[model samples]
Target: MDDVAKGQNLDDFLINLADGLSRAQSRLNRYPVMNAVGQQSMVYHIPRLEFELKLQMTAAETPASSGSGGRLPLQKKSRVQFLPVKASQHQSSSSATSIIKGVFVATPLDATVSQVRLSLSVEKKAARKAQVNVAVIAAPGRSVQGATVELNIDRELSERLNKTPLKPSTRLEQASLILNQESVASAGLIIANQEPEGQIIALIADLFGQTQTLLYRFEQG
Candidate 1:
């Protein structure tokens, strides 16, 4: 689900749960969030709003105009930087390994773009497994509904990662961090054995380029 839709879903969960707040203290413990400072307290109403939005989105058979001129898959312009990959021990060509990481960033989706997808990777020696962390930083004026962000690993890459072995002490990748509206963008790393370093970097570049191309087309339109 897109960030908006997931948020909406979470909102509904909270509201429904809140309805039974008669035993306030009992349920209160269930959600330590309500005890938070200021804005955190407002987390209580999320569930209700999410439920309502879900109903509305579902009832609307036709795509409700987003009230914007963005393309079918709306996306925004954003930049991704791959910080260095520090591995414990570099492997030779004979080894098949893979390393992956998440590069998080915060920026707006071009008025023309609606969806955003990213990929990050590093060289590998032996066949290894890889994973990526994904998130959506909502756009200011746009709405994302049931937005599905998929992590695609081609058959060839998938097979390679599954068979690679891991390097015990190497920090193939770093952990990913999730950021919100007021927070800075960040990412996590999932390094493995199998995928080549050159191949991994190229894949990441390709993912960014593809997103850029989509945004470009939308802007040009």
Candidate 2:
């Protein structure tokens, strides 16, 4: 689809999306169930890459480690798994939650949560191609790990990339990375010759019972 049509579709789609979320938020307010999180998930629709970051509350009752609204903490482990599901089969919030099941691991109540900046660079290889470079800068004496990096590309563009042996995709059908001080994550892309849209990348640091979450998005269009 062209840019104009895509924009039109997105506009129309948001109408339903807003209304649905409004209703869902009401239900969530009425029933703050399992997830002991501020926001269970923040969804992005690049026509359904379906990236979901969920915070769930467990009643294990060990200690109040990490929870919102005076809830208890969990002792679960962090897990990352990739599953390929057809868009047609993705129908409900339950299914969406199932998509990215274990996004965050357990954290200690005393562990502090803070925001730190990381470097993201894009070098143009051609009008239709570029290399994405990501760097995580930390305090000279501190340690940082690129726990997770999410990149949102057009759905069709992503599929095309898969056929050409691009880097592995996340459960969100895009890119997820694990980078350390000694390594970085870089990839080249050609989005049908388009200059590429602003990407929505999440940098999660899940070391030492702390979770540093960053949501950054930019689009050329």
Candidate 3:
């Protein structure tokens, strides 16, 4: 049963039990034939019942709003971080695998991120020709599952990244990467096995223009 229903039922039970105990006590007091020992035992039991009743009443009266006690204020910014994955190992291979397996992204429980974009580079050169794939997976805490969003890069920008060299100081705006807020909030990027050895940069931006970046490097194991 739901919490509210359970609480109501408990309240009714306690009330009935209390009324029955009171009636029994009154009957014992009115009957002079009852031995003093029985009366004393009844008195002791009364206090214990009262204590239990008080406990239950207190619990029932407690506010249900306490469920949100652990939640922080919505205005607070949450820190975002990348979950680490074990480096891939290959035997009889001359080069370390650049493919990153199982990439997981995380945000604060109340994060307000609206957009997410990824930048990739190898040997300081833009890896625009490389395709980055991602799959959305469960995040920590009570976040909803199966929410997947896809990011779409425009052809002009894709062509630019493929042709032009990427500068270390390049801003995300300069790259003209367009990110859908809904998709970024629910999805993560996946780099397949064919990706080049480089640094994968994740740029997450909130609605307020505040941005956070997580960088992952793929090297030969």
lDDT-better candidate, 1 vs 2: 2
lDDT of each: 0.31, 0.39, 0.32
lDDT of 3 by residue, 148-199 (tens): 3223322232233343322343232223232343222322233334544553
lDDT digits (tens) for residues 67-146 of candidate 1: 46755554442222212224554534433333332222324446677444333332223334333334444445644344
For TM-score, the strongest prediction is 2
- The number of clashing residue pairs in model 3 is 4
lDDT of 2 at 43: 30
Residue 101 local lDDT, model 2:
30
Q: Which stretches of candidate 1 lie above 4 Å from their native place?
A: 1-127, 153-201, 204-221
Runs with alpha carbons beyond 4 Å of true place in candidate 3: 1-186, 219-221
What total of clashing residue pairs does each candidate reach? 49, 6, 4
